[model samples]
Target chain A: AQSVAQPEDQVNVAEGNPLTVKCTYSVSGNPYLFWYVQYPNRGLQFLLKYITGDNLVKGSYGFEAEFNKSQTSFHLKKPSALVSDSALYFCAVRDYYGNNRLAFGKGNQVVVIP
Target chain B: DTAVSQTPKYLVTQMGNDKSIKCEQNLGHDTMYWYKQDSKKFLKIMFSYNNKELIINETVPNRFSPKSPDKAHLNLHINSLELGDSAVYFCASSQVEGGETQYFGPGTRLLVL
Candidate 1:
């Protein structure tokens, strides 16, 4: 079984400030990790993924995530936050050698203060 | 163009009633999935289909059934809906052989009274 944990319930960042959201995972074999963002009343949009190689994965809308194998963590980051960045963020993981199902973490609500 | 889409953005019904949610993906993907988001915003996978074949079925009650008539469509049917079943249901899809990123559709918010 694969699982993901997002430690924070919400993250508040002022506009133009750096933003970060934490995520951890537990999987049997290698982990295929992904990040998604959901706006209010909209579907989740694919942001980025970490399948193999490239610990620093850059994604849509100036978002980037670092995959740390040793720490069992994949933390999302943005250099500067924008008010439009306020949304729900989710982290997901799946066993590379296991089933196709993805285990998602409880989302983190990001509030970018303007 | 919308890659994935779902019908009936909001569903309000009484308990014990049956309802269906429809999903379609036009990204030429081979896999489709159904996920539920609870009131607390927790998301969980309920069912998945690969090429119109059931692939992943999580620990869910038998009252929920999923049907995939073709590669582009997967519909969910619920029987004897309970209050606990109320949640936002999202449909997603991915090309199993191409990449791992799954595209999602606007969720269907079901409210059971």
Candidate 2:
């Protein structure tokens, strides 16, 4: 079965500091990975996705993620964190089975403090 | 205009009652889906429809039935609602079945008394 794993339950970072939220996946074949962020009492918003032909993918809200095929990892990163960046993050993967469904990670809560 | 929209932002009903949550997307996407967010804040896919055809149906109970009148709308109907059914339900739409970004709605909070 294909699945995604977010190792960190929560991450705390200072404003203006680089932040990284780790995520790894397990799939039978090549993976199409995605990252989404959720604000309190709001729906999940798309951040970025890595389909192919690019190790680094940039997305909305000044967010970017690096895809590592060797380690089956797709970690989300931001150059400079802001207090507004504090939210819950989820990593997802679309398996080769072609169900048009995505397997999502448990999710990670990120807190950016001043 | 809202790309995706769901009706009854908040629902509170007694147990064993029936209710329905309606979803509509004006993005003209070909696929729509329903996801449940539990009390622990875990989101899980419940059902999906593509062009009015059932595409993905997860391990959801039969009490939960999804109906898609058209490609742009997918509605969830729950019969004999239970206490465990209290959670926020989100409706989403995508261009295709897989490998595409999904647009989500504001979500509907359902509570079973």
Candidate 3:
């Protein structure tokens, strides 16, 4: 079984400040990880994914995530924060050899204050 | 254009009633899925259909049935809806199976009284 954890329920950041939303996963075999963001009353939108290759994966809207193997973490990071970046973020992991289901975290609410 | 879409964005019904949520994807994807988001915002996969065939069925109750009449549509039908069954149901689709990015719909919020 594959699982993901976002320890923090919410993260507050001021505009122009760096932001980080933490995520970690446990899975069998190679892991196909993903990050998604959901706005209020809207569906989740794919931000980025880590399949194979680079540890630092860049995504849409100036967002990036670092996949740390030894730490078993995939934390999202941004150089600067914007009030519009406020939303709910989810972390997911899919086991390569398993039944092929994407297990998601409880989600983290990000509030970028202006 | 909307890649994936679900009908009846908000559904309010009484317990023991029957209801259905419809989903469709227009990204020419072969696989579609149904997911449930509880009040605490926990997302879990309930069912999946690839090319009109049932592929993934999680620990969902038998009262919930999914029907895929065609490749682009997968509808969920619930029999005797219970209060515990109330949640936001999202429909999504991916281009392929096993490790693929899924496109999600706006979701249908079901509230059972």
Candidate 4:
């Protein structure tokens, strides 16, 4: 079974500071990982995806994620946090060789303080 | 233009009543899916349709039925609404041939009284 775990329930960071939202995964073959963000009362928007390539994948809104095969982790990062970046983040994973279903982690609420 | 869209952004109804939520995607994708998000924000896949064919059906109850009129539309009908059925339902679509990057719709918030 493919699954993702987000350890933090909430992450607090000051504006202009680097922020990290932790995510780890377990899957059968190589994993296809994804990051999504959701604002209050809005649908989730795709941030980035790691299919197979360089370890670091850059995505929308200046967000990036690094895929660590040994650590089985794909952590979302932003060089400088903005107060508008405060939202819920979700990490998802799917098996590369098997089903199309994506297993999602419990979301993390990020608060960027001004 | 919205890529994926769902009707009845908010629904409040009594238990044992029947209701339906419609979803449409104009992205020209081959696969459409339904997802349920609980109060705690845990998302679970309920059903998926690919080109009007049932591709994935999770362990959902029989009271819930999903119908895909075409590749672009997937509608969910609930027979007997329950308190447990209250949650946010999302519709998403992706090109199955490509890497699985699903685009989501503005969710429909359903509240069963």
Candidate 5:
């Protein structure tokens, strides 16, 4: 079984400041990690993913995440935050050769203060 | 164009009522999935269909059933809905399978009263 954990319930960052949302995972085989964002009543929107090489993976809306193998972590990051970036962020994972189920984290609510 | 879409965006019904939510994907994906997001915003997969064949069925109750008339459409029906059954249902689809990005619908919000 694969699982993802986003330790923070809510993250607060000032506009133009750096933002980070921590994530960790536990899986059997190689991990396929992903990040998704959800606004108000909308469903999850893909942000970025880390499948193989390049520990630093960039994604939509200027968001990025780093895959730290030794730490079993994939933390989402943004160089400079915007008020519009405030949303619920999720970290999901599935074993590379495992079944088709992608386990999701208990989403972190981001509040980008203007 | 909309890659994935779901019908009855908001559903409000009483306990013991039966309701259905319809989902469609125009992305030409062969795999689709159903997920439930509880009040705590924790998402859990309920079922997945690949090319109209059931591929993944989690520990969901038998009262909740998923039907895929075609590869592009997947519908979910619930019988004897309980108060705890109220949650947001999201439909997602991915091309082929494993490790691919899954496009999601706007989600169907169900409220059991």
Candidate 6:
């Protein structure tokens, strides 16, 4: 089964500092990875995805993710974090050959302190 | 305008009662999906429809039935709601199935008392 793992339960970082939310995946064949962020009481918002192509993918809200095929990881990153960036982040993987259902990670709560 | 919209943003109902949540997508997407976000914030896919056809149905209970009246509308109806059913339900849509980015609605928070 295809699955995603976000090892960290919470990550705290200071404003303006670089932040990273780690994500690793286990899937057969090439993986389709995605990063989603959720604000309090809001639905999951798309941040970035890696289907096929360059290892680094940029997305909305100044977010970017690096896809590492060798490491089987797709980590979400931001150059400078803001207090507003504090939210829950989820890493999801889609089964390419299956029913196209997405399996999401447990989610990591990011706290960008001002 | 909201690309994907869900009715009853917050729903509080008594146990053993029936409730329904409606979803609509104006993006002209052919695929719509329902996901449940539990208290731990783990998202799980419940059902999916493509062009009014049921394509992907997970191991959801029979009490939970999804109706897709048209390509643009998908509704979830639950009978005899249980406490475990109290979670955030999100409706999403994509231009196509698989490898497509899904646009999500604000989500409906259901609380079974």
Q: What is the C-alpha lDDT of each candidate?
A: 0.94, 0.92, 0.94, 0.95, 0.95, 0.93
lDDT of 3 by residue, A5-78 (tens): 99999999999999999999998788899999999999999999999899999999999999999998999999
lDDT of 1 by residue, B1-113 (tens): 98999999999999999999999999999999999999999999999999999989999999999999999999999999999999999999997743378899999999999
Write one digit per residue (lDDT tens) for candidate 1, span A11-100: 999999999999999988889999999999999999999988889999999999999999999999999999999999999998887667
Candidate 5 off by > 4 Å = none
Candidate 4 error regions (>4 Å): none
lDDT comparing candidate 1 with the true structure: 0.94
Q: Each candidate's root-mean-square deviation in Å?
A: 1.1, 1.0, 0.9, 0.8, 0.8, 0.8
- Chain A of model 1 scored by TM-score: 0.98
lDDT of 2 by residue, B42-106 (tens): 88899989899998899999999999999989999999999999999999999774578988999
Clashes of each: 0, 1, 0, 0, 0, 0
A1-104 per-residue lDDT for model 4 (tens digits): 99999999999999999999999999989999999999998899999999988999999999999999999999999999999999999999999876679899
Question: Across residues A44-67, which tens digit of lDDT does each residue of candidate 5 receive?
Answer: 999999999999999999999999
Q: Would candidate 4 be rated incorrect, acceptable, medium or high by CAPRI criteria? A: medium
Residues A1-91 of candidate 6 have per-residue lDDT tens digits of 8999899999999999999999999998778889999999988899989998889999999999999988999999999999999999999
What's the TM-score, to 2 decimals, of chain B in model 1?
0.97
- For each candidate, what TM-score against the reference? 0.98, 0.97, 0.98, 0.99, 0.98, 0.98
TM-scores of chain A across the candidates, in order, are 0.98, 0.97, 0.98, 0.99, 0.98, 0.98
Q: Candidate 6 residues B1-113, lDDT tens each?
A: 99999999999999999999999999999999999999998899999998899988999999999999999999999999999999999999996656899889999999999
The DockQ of predicted model 5 stands at 0.82
Candidate 1's error at B50, in angstroms? 0.7
Alpha-carbon RMSD, candidate 1: 1.1
Better of 1 and 4 by TM-score: 4
Which pairs clash (backbone N, Cα, C closer than 3 Å) in model 6? none
What DockQ does candidate 2 score?
0.71
Question: DockQ of every model listed?
Answer: 0.68, 0.71, 0.79, 0.74, 0.82, 0.79
